[model samples]
Target chain A: MSRTKLDLWVGFFVVIGMGALLFLALKVGNLGGSNFTDTYVVMARFDNIGGLKVRAPVKSAGVVVGRVTNIGFDTSGYRAEVTFALDTRYQFPRDTIATILTSGLLGEQYLGLDPGGEAEMLKGGEVVQITQSAVVLEKLIGQFMFDKAAEAPAN
Target chain B: MNGLLNVVRLLGAMVTEAIWRTGFGARFFILLLRHSGQSLTRVHLTIRELYFSGVLSLLIIVVSGLFVGMVLAMQGYETLQRYGSGDALGVLVALSLTRELGPVVAGLLFASRAGLAVTAEIGLMKTTEQLDAMDMMAVNPIARVVAPRFWGGVISMPLLAALFSAMGVFGGWLIGVVLIGVDEGAFWSQMQAAVDFRFDIMNGVVKSVVFGAAVSLIAVFEGYDCTPTAEGLSRAITRTVVTSALAILALDFVLTSLMFRGQS
Candidate 1:
């Protein structure tokens, strides 16, 4: 009887421990990083999204304050439009410029917002008119190769 | 022409005998099922066996699972960090534990510990004429001895697999967050978002059930056919462990291939 009781207790503890661990993992990993609520939406148009995926961080003055929620193409504009969820607390002026910036030399792409001094704040669903597209690495590489070839011939 | 005729005759005889044995085995299975109604009365006996086998084996399983999880997480973190994608650790641990390590490791451990004991016990009964005595008393030995054990193992293996998976994931979390200073919240949430209960838990349980059936059948079959001697019993036990472990691994590979053939 004692052995049976002990067995049951052990089984109970194992189940409880597992359940707790699963709960903690879900709560921490998913909810902590990105707080989508209390955030407004803004749209930016680009020729290419590049390596920018959904949930890519959006930064303002080097601080992450939002994330990219959706990326689609505008048939009329013939441009890729990225929808961003921005914190409502940070009011973006109408003249703010949104640029796709790389975090490092070989890092993920993020949307960086430059707030311009303006009295009117951009509201939800408003498009940020001043948008800088992602830097095309292929074009940069082609230019570098061309410059190298020209310099080598001259030398 | 004469040599070819002899070979053809031998092949025909072998096929005939094989078919006859298969039919006999099928009939034996049906008879065992008919007698399986007695299993309801033997539930207590099965539970007792489970307590001794599964519950008693918890410490070893937990310790091993914890270490395996920790090692996996540490290695996974290092590799992911190299690619600057350390955030994907949760997915890595969850997927590995659920799909691969959980059932295979638990099955191997169970085969080593419980499989040997079961084989030896049944082998001893066969050698001691205890099985013959049961038959004389109008008791079907397979139904009474083998079926209860088979059912018990079938039930216990899944529970053990679940326990192993849970412990392993916790171990990974401990290594990732407490020891390695990963963002505790991020690691956990990523694991949750990545692992679905259907894909992880269900997959593990299905593998465990198949492993349980294979282990129990192989162990019981080996024991039942053992030579009536002490040395034979020892050999039977050794064979049981080896065969069950191998069967578990082979079945795991087959199941994994079938399950994930088109998915990835």
Candidate 2:
């Protein structure tokens, strides 16, 4: 192979390979693509968090505004507390409704925020008072079965 | 009765011979590793071998990648349609290609295309006395002949795999979005939301790298160990293909399990 030709092809090869890998990582995987590095952390409490994982997307208006940073048990309240860092660009009112939601019917759980009409704004470390817990599919099915059994005995 | 007894003895001898061959191959592989340092200084030779093994294999890799991706999209649509999630074709195709098929299929293709050629070229040189001539000239053939090709294969494998994956994803998009009636936004957005860079993409790169090392090791060792004869050279080339393919697949399985063990 000619020296220049070899160098040219090798350079092309390296560039394309790296480009594909970067596209797969940043575009397909959405890794390091999140622009929420500089953000504020807020916590919320739920009776059941279900399968809401750390790093799960926190969406507002169906657009990801932040990510779940941590999850812990609140021993005093006997509830699950979730902390998320919301990008400062997307300001939220103090009366925002934060609810746990699953993307698809059987997909990952994320925190969904619905802005409420409030003149005041939420600050960092502030707890969201209005929270909806995750829907426990298994528990719902068990309760449904118990209700059916109870009705059958009464009948 | 005598023939039956002879057959039993032959079987036992064959097993022992296979064990001996494995040991010899292992030693040869270790020697290649030792001589690999010489490859760093022989930049010209390494580049030449890379042209042969890497540049020459691009056409086949790209073509196969595109076709594989197209097929995946078509099949994925059929299956996903039942769930009324046909729009998620991009996610299905991307996940399958990047995580598993991309590295595995590309490694197999690389072995068939480049690994076999390395084996045959080396085996021919040995049979034709070029290697022995180098030895007489006070040159170490392993450093000059084997190490460059080994390095070339190792470097080329991952790049080829990445190219394959890219082409495959494009092919799938052509079919799923352009040809079929799937929602273009859902296909891409869902894929981005689901796959993880560290988990899926990095694991695939790791698999391809390990496969590259294993296949190149098998190829060089097979070529070096062959008897200096026409039949021996042909046998070495065939062995190179079969062994490298088997090694790639087995390594893919072991690596995949380890990478995804704790994942739900």
Report the number of the highest-DockQ candidate. 2
Off by over 4 Å in 1: A1-155, B1-32
What would the per-residue lDDT of candidate 1 be over residues B38-79, giving only the tens digit for each residue?
666756656656765676667777788888889999999999
Q: Could you tell me how far off, in angstroms, the CA of residue A35 lies in candidate 1 after the best superposition? A: 20
**lDDT at position B61, candidate 2:** 90
Residue range A3-40, candidate 1, lDDT tens digits: 56755754664464355335433432334444556999
- Model 2 docking category: acceptable
TM-score of the B chain in each candidate versus the native B chain:
0.87, 0.96
Candidates' DockQ values? 0.12, 0.43
Candidate 2: regions farther than 4 A off: A35-101, A110-134, A148-155, B1-8
TM-score of each: 0.63, 0.81
Measured by C-alpha RMSD in angstroms, how accurate is candidate 2?
A: 4.9
Tens digits of lDDT, candidate 2, B8-124: 999999999999999987888788889888788868888777887888888999999999999999999999999888988988999999989999999999999999999988998
Candidate 2 chain A weakest lDDT stretch, 10 residues: A28-37
